[model samples]
Target: MPKIVDREERRREVVEAVFRVVARGGIQQATLQNVAAEAGLAVGSVRHYFESHPELLTAAAREMVHRVEARVRAQRERLGPDDDPHDVAEEIAGQFLPLDAARADETAVWLEFAVAARTDPALGPIAVELHDGLRTVAGRLLHRLGVDDPVATEHLAAVLDGLALNAALHPDRLRPDAVRAVLRRHLAQLPGGR
Candidate 1:
């Protein structure tokens, strides 16, 4: 008899292995063999889902995006559009911060992969695409908030990224409310945000 496989589920498992490898040893060490061991599968098993290491890294980046988008969507759904602006902003940005164990793990993995992206030619494009996609999402959110300023959406996205990075490094420096306050201040600085 032959074994059966759920292709999608197996792929997700492999992507998760990539995350674990990154979190434990950084992306530089997340070779196919490491990922296979992290996933508790044979190298061929992992390769069955991803044709190569580059493919695995790219998939991991995409998986990170999916994780973020899923969290944001769920948070937005729970808060609804009527939530306070500060609360809404906090919730959205919180998705990126390592405020909890799960998020901390994700942050570690993401940072490792990001560092690898800088020098790994194969992963560079994946990182760029992820960065651009997130920026677009943030820009659209700013546009929806009526922040069509001189610099436009790009500025808004940049601000979000800056805040997220800062919050991740020094949570004590910015607190959730502080993050919201900064965002509110930015909005108030806009032409008619007040």
Candidate 2:
């Protein structure tokens, strides 16, 4: 008899290990051996699922995108028809913020991948996809709130990006409550936001 494995679950564990590795160090540290050690599995076992280092990073980055997308979808679904614009903004944008430990870790991994993708050709396209996806989400969220100006969408998207970046870099300066307040404040700056 042999040990049966749940491939998807194991794969997810490997992805999470990659996240931990990237968060602790940077993308350069998320090699097959390190990730396997983080995941508490053998290197061969990780390779069984990912084949190569680039493939592992690619898969992990894709998983991060899917997780963020799923979170945004859930946030949208959870909103009631009568929720206020500020409330909606906070809820949706909150998905991308480094609010707590879990969100901070996720944000760290995202930042690492994004910076690495700037130089790594293998990650460039997915990085663009992640960037465009968030921008599109911001635009759609603004559109739903009756804001048609593309500038408004850029405003919202840039605010989110800045907040996430600062929160990751300066957690003491831009704490969780401050992150929410900054977003709401940005929304209030827009026309008809009040």
Candidate 3:
């Protein structure tokens, strides 16, 4: 029998190729040819999965968001019942930072997509969705800490974004240890922090 192809898995592979291209270079370099080469497939194969560049970009962005959310949820589930609320908040917020190699790659790709979304109409909505999702996470953390301020949630979201951007771009300067320390300190200073 002829080999069967997993279309959904193949599409995920193509999306991962796009992420590799963007993470290695930038969004500008994530062309169909480069992505195909990265995935060890022909350009025609890539086209078979995604008809156009915009569709591929959108898929890659969505995949990155999905990965980030999965990681965050997993981390949240690992928390102990007796863990301090502030510590829990810190751990949850740390999920957004580039503390490890996989997270660093995801952060790099996410930042590229967010920047490109500024002018790309197709990517703008994805970017907004990502922003809102992060803010909602921040709000939950704030509520857990007994704070109920929308502005505080927004500020925390911005802080997390800045920290992730800095850690992703300058890992040498802002090491994971430093990022954790900064995040712990920030969480400690929150209104209801212990």
Per-candidate local distance difference test:
0.74, 0.89, 0.92
- Give per-model TM-scores: 0.78, 0.96, 0.96
lDDT: the better of candidates 2 and 3: 3
TM-score of 1: 0.78
lDDT of 2 by residue, 137-174 (tens): 88877876788888888878888989999999999999
Estimate candidate 2's RMSD in Å.
1.1
Candidate 1 clashing pairs, residues 3+ apart or interchain = none
lDDT of 3 at 120: 100
Better of 1 and 3 by TM-score: 3
Candidate 3, 109-169: lDDT as tens digits? 9999999999999999999999999999999999988899999999899889999999988
Candidate 1 lDDT, 1-194, residue by residue in tens:
89998999999998988888776677788899999998899999988889988889889887887898899889878887676654565567567656676776677777776778888887787678767876666665656566655475666666666776676567778665776677667655654456
Q: By how many angstroms RMSD does model 1 differ from the true structure?
A: 3.1
Off by over 4 Å in 1: 150-156, 166-194
For model 1 the local lDDT of residue 171 reads 72
Backbone clashes, candidate 1: 0
Which regions in candidate 3 have their CA more than 4 angstroms from the true location? none
Report the number of the highest-lDDT candidate.
3
